[model samples]
Target: MEPSKSSDDKQVAPPRRVSFKYRSGPAALRCLSDGLVYFAKPSEFNDCLEAKFDHSSVADYIERMDRSIRSVSEQRSCAGGYAVPEGDLASFEAKTACDDVNFLEATQRVGIYSTASRPDNQPMWTYYSDNSKGFCFELEWPDTVLGRYQIAPVGVLYSSAARVHNRADIFDTLIREEAELHPDWSMDQILEETRSEFFRFRFQMLNTCRAVSIKHSDWSHEHEVRFVTPRAGPLPIMGQILKRVYFVRTDFPEWGPVMMLLHQLYPTVELAKMSFQHVEPYVRVQGMTKKLVPVHE
Candidate 1:
């Protein structure tokens, strides 16, 4: 009898199974037969997770993978080095040595900063050695919602004993001799006239005695000071105020102590009133260009 149209449509297809070859290495195959741990299976004797090698020749590849994993783990753990306590400047200063005595020792003895501050919201402190290199410490604040954070080195301070005495003598002599020579010029006028000289002298003294020097020169005597940057070129300014006030404060209380404060202070009283503006559109364009361009070595 002939089959019906329904029977023809109901014809069955053969079953299909997907399979892959399992090639064993000499070491792994040997281990499998000897009841030893295979690379693909968990070992009964040890709790450690290890790649079972089929051959001893693949030991180098296993070692390389192990090293790479350990390196990545270590880097993640050391993402933030250390944190600074949140408190008044005085309290923070007191704990300077405690948080890391090793850092203090290195700074004082070898002129190096080993430990860095964790980045935090509270005003962070960064230690600088040789006035150029800086190490930041993170700070923790109790009142903020963010909890704690890190900050980079934004300022520096220095002190020197010899600078104090020398400055005193030089200023005294200049006042005496200049007053006698230019009696017509008032004390204020003389100071205004020789401001550049005073700045140069101060800079030289600091360079000789201190490890680091702030990057500013005084041209108070000149009608205008030129401000230059690598990317921005020269900055505009008013007359008779040629140089920016770079040094915040300096103190020479006695022969042994000479304190200098260096910081990213806000502009002086004059610049505060000027209409300083930034072009956000230009900045955005620059940022986009940087992102899209692929840098080549």
Candidate 2:
């Protein structure tokens, strides 16, 4: 069990600030065995996370994960022991040693997220809304539905912090375009959604500290992700997960200290609707993390 870090203990030593940049392989979810605990059986595990993957698809999640793990290690070895080039100051959370300009143009940093609250599992998916976001999550024990659950590796989110504020605004424009695409929705509805999302985004940003999305390229996934770790099979492809209802647990003591307000919510909530006091509590308490900053961002 991950012992709760007493406030005083945190003052003594915190885990090295979790790299918001996701690292796959043994680093992210940490290991395949730990990730399997979230699954009920092996078949389901294979479906949701078999990195040795057997099927073929446009985006072979596991294959990509496997290759990424190897490639990143190689880059580190060749980096001459430097994490980044000495002078760039680019987003350090996720990057390849090359420092390609196209990489930045293709990606956007909207929120800065720290690592998910520490547990054996990392954030596979959590903190989503109808405009839901997931890829890491956890549930406490003794719960009727999901017991303590989580997956590893982590991903980037844009930071709402002052330094990145301008970049975040640039990223929000995508939401604006998405809002425009929905001609039938009302202004109040959109603002309410934005109001609550930003509230959660701000809080989540405070929690994790970065959310960055980059364009998909054969080479990029190798060094810059922690979200899927060989990826999940039973778990749906991330592209299919947006804008839907999701259930979130509120009683988990596991989240107790990580979220200062864990006791503030009821229990499971329908996250997508965005119209209830119950659901809003999580946005504050456990903001659903986006799967990854989508490639389009």
Candidate 3:
């Protein structure tokens, strides 16, 4: 199936055909043996504001709130020939507050497996690869298992400011206008229809690909790509997709075990040593132990 397009119908193009994953020695060993990678919850990440929703368009939220209140008021006025109850008004206010809180909290369920477009990034090795004591795996993504899980790697969008999720931007007035198209429908019918459409719109708008693919500009150096899923756990990886392993430190305590495991489990995988230079480009990969197969070949 084709990827679900956004309102603008655009997709995040991969920087290159291949992406890289940085892992500690133990994590690399585990992944090499089990052919699985962990998809961590957004909250588990170093970012304190991971998956936090900032729906700060007060005017838009109030506009929708007023429409809801008016709908209830009209219904109550018709039903008992009296004013809407104070309790019901309070309930509406409470529900609005709850929705905001729930949106922010629900990000815990989001699963993210982060990758980078470039393998040569210095900080990537320092921060993610146990300060270059671990290793990095260069893999071809969109493999069978990931595709089966409907997980696609999307390029992350970097912004100088926090991503502000405006409710008005997502659940646009199109649905309301669509409901208005049905002039013959009663207010009750319209309300029911609008509520149903609203939920459907929310589901489409709250997509993992679109919602979590954004980050603060501070992370721009990572050139990050992410395989996002609704659930967090060990995601299966097909063996053949792991093309190469680049080890930064031969002195890593488990180097022997890691090398042995790689040789046994992935004999055809090219092994390379990465080095740091004092020149302009600090990080470089050279001297592969195993010959790299030409892609076209």
Candidate 4:
């Protein structure tokens, strides 16, 4: 769905990017076998703060509620529509406040996110890839694959501290247009009609980015990128999105069958084994060495 037109919309040039997903052997096998990648909910994430943000605070909710009500009221008065009187606005704000918070919380729980990282992040392998006992998939964003699956990767924004987004103007234009279109309806009715649109635009706003793409700066080492969808489930992979597979240790006992299955299923994908080498004088930095080896039948 196209993002609603608003000042909050940001125009970003799409960059050519690739990402890597580290998975255990069984999980990788399941992904390849079913041709479906599981998009998990934030509640399933290891981080307790996974989709939490200051945008969900009561202060932000009240501000957004006030703006939406005022915008609708003004639009109706200007367009000669059914306008809500100023006195009744206090009651309207109180009622909509609950709806705003409820909808935001519901959307947060329903949204599903998938994550990947820069290929060279060793810690990602340790934490996510079963500590070198599993493997990683290198994914490229080919137009065909991304367009088919609707997978637009957003690079995570890492912040050193908490942020407060008091974005009261989020749904102003959209609600105004809706009021103009349905001039006969009361503000309550108009708002009810546009409830989904309001929350949808709110989540897509630049400040929030759907409440999933921002992370704490402490996690900057992962260099994470994420793909998000409102619906949570197995999304089938239809095109050549999987470019390569990196085995953390080919010597692992379970790799024999997993390799055979991978070769049988995705014969054209490049397979490689990853190892780390330490260079003297650069003690803090470790270089990843990969040997590209074809999977044999």
Residue 232 of candidate 4: its Cα lDDT?
57
Instruction: Look at candidate 4 and give me any clashing residue pairs.
Output: none
Query: Stretches of candidate 2 above 4 Å error?
Result: 1-167, 170-174, 177-181, 186-188, 197-221, 228-297
Best by lDDT: 3
Q: How much is 122 displaced in model 1, in angstroms?
A: 65
Q: Which parts of model 4 are misplaced by more than 4 Å?
A: 1-15, 54-92, 95-99, 143-152, 163-208, 280-297
Return the TM-score for candidate 3, rounded to 2 decimals. Answer: 0.64
In candidate 3, which residue pairs get closer than 3 Å at backbone N, Cα or C atoms, i.e. clash?
none
lDDT of 1 at 127: 16
Looking at model 4, report the run of 10 residues with the lowest lDDT sum: 282-291
Writing each residue's lDDT as its tens digit, candidate 1 over 1-297 gives 111223124668664211111111232123223322111112221213111111111233234434443343343442211123344545654553253343222222211111112111111111121121111111121222111211111122222222111222233344445556775655455446446775555433332222221112231111111111112111121111111111111121210111011011112211100111266332110100001235799
Error of 1 at 191 (Å): 2.0
**Where does model 1 exceed 4 Å of error?**
1-166, 197-199, 202-297
Q: Rank the candidates by lDDT, best first.
A: 3, 4, 2, 1
Each model's TM-score, in the order given? 0.15, 0.21, 0.64, 0.63
lDDT of 2 by residue, 1-297 (tens): 122233323456533322222222222222112322221222332123211111122123223433433343343342211123435435342332232232232222221122333221213222121112211223222221111222333443322222222232322443354355665655445445545766545433322222232222432322333332122233321111111112233343322232222112212311221112445343332233222133663
